[model samples]
Target: MIEEARIKKNLKQFTFPRLSGTDYEIKAYKKLTKEVENLNLKYKVQFFTFSSFYSRIYPKIGFSSVSIILFLFYLNIHMSISIILILILFTILIISIILTRKPEKIQFITKMDSQNVLVKIKSLSKEKKNYDRIALFISHLDSKGQRFTIKIRIRIFKLWITSSISLTATIISKNSILRGFELIFYIIGLFPLIFNLLSTIMMLLNTTDNSSDGAVDNASGIACNLELLNHYSIPENRLIIIYGFFLLELKNAEQWVLDIFIII
Candidate 1:
């Protein structure tokens, strides 16, 4: 049977200023460790850093958009080889930036150290398969604060529509310099630029207003994971069950035990 009381205790203990890399997240990690230890369960803790405050792709698109915007500011309505060269440069920039966007590019300003709590229970049942297997019960201990919701999704769809039109217009327009390549560059880069720019604005707002209590979003998942650990045991011979508590999941930073899970 699942223990609802542990869920409440976790929710109560999770009530803190958990902004990814801040002291709040650290405290939460500590609390998680304590909980597992109280169960007399052996676990491992792995720490990692990620770009929580500022995303790398946001600024890349922003710079590309601003550059195209400025180039169009003084552009003339004429076709020229220079316009083609500009397109090539912009394409190269965008592609290279996207390719190089690894975890290391995370901004140094707010690069945060987050923890993953991992618990493994060997299966008790006999294995029928020829190969060893593992199963993961994944959950996140942190919550996210979002200031923008469906409005942003609607806007993104609108931007994509306009951007498609803009790209098509570039192909048919007579003046390749003024309207074709120039507008296409602006539209392509501006998509992410505008979206992330608005996201940044909402993030700024969320920074001041702490209205997000993400109990149902992910605290419930963690609570269920803990309950499984507390009340039940997996069939060891069938599979090795691994429970992982991920941080910065909302930030697209779940790279840690994933490789191990995939390899085995």
Candidate 2:
């Protein structure tokens, strides 16, 4: 059974910013390992390196691509130029998607080391070796602080995208009524550019800090995982349960790579 008291205790202990690739995060990992050991639960620690380049470059790419696309529209440039820009944008998007799927392919610049803690439990069935299924309980242990909260950032980005799309639609529409208001649409389109430019600048100036404790995002998750580990550690449990404490979900100083655990 999951105990609220135990969850609260764990949450209290872990309620602080533990940014990835930093000493605090390492310390938190150590403490978590200690807790698992105290529970007499076997666990594995996975250490791996990752680059923050993907995370940092995304905003810049969005800003630049949008800027160029709008500029081409504003100038009513040659179709050849517009096509080339579109092709370039498509290529970049494809490459970025590929890179996101395969972090190992990323170059070593801004590389940082982080770890995950995993606890795997096997079924106690007579045919233990042939356990039917595996279960996973995952949580992230790190937190990040930024100039703007996620909500604010999301809203700003959405506004920018919506304005850009509206402008593009209005400018390119065949309807005579829409075409007559091209200048007004263009002016409205500029609002998103201002937002995009400011966002890009903010991203560039962003620095890692320990302001957010991340209780909800998520010490609560860790606490729940811990309780699950405690409950499933018994030999009588019928299913295989793997509890994983990952480095993080948010990008702090560097990215935290997952799926790199070594069973002990």
Best candidate (score: TM-score) = 2
How do the residues 99-212 of candidate 2 rate in per-residue lDDT, one tens digit apiece? 777664576558878887877777777674555445667788887777677897777667657656665665565234577776676676566556555655554555556688
Candidate 1's C-alpha runs over 4 A off are 15-17, 52-101, 104-109, 126-131, 153-157, 160-171, 174-211, 233-239, 250-264
| Tens digit of per-residue lDDT, candidate 1, span 1-264 | 566787788766676556566676677778877878877778987777776424433443544453444344334335575577567767766665664466445555556677778887766656544224556787777766555554764564465445445544443352454554655655555554455445434434433223456677576777777777776442432356777887755334355345344321
Clashing pairs in 1: 122-236, 123-235, 123-236, 123-237, 124-235, 124-236, 125-236
lDDT of each: 0.59, 0.70
lDDT of 2: 0.70
Superposed by TM-score, candidate 1 places the C-alpha of residue 201 at a distance from the truth, in angstroms, of 8.7
Best by lDDT: 2
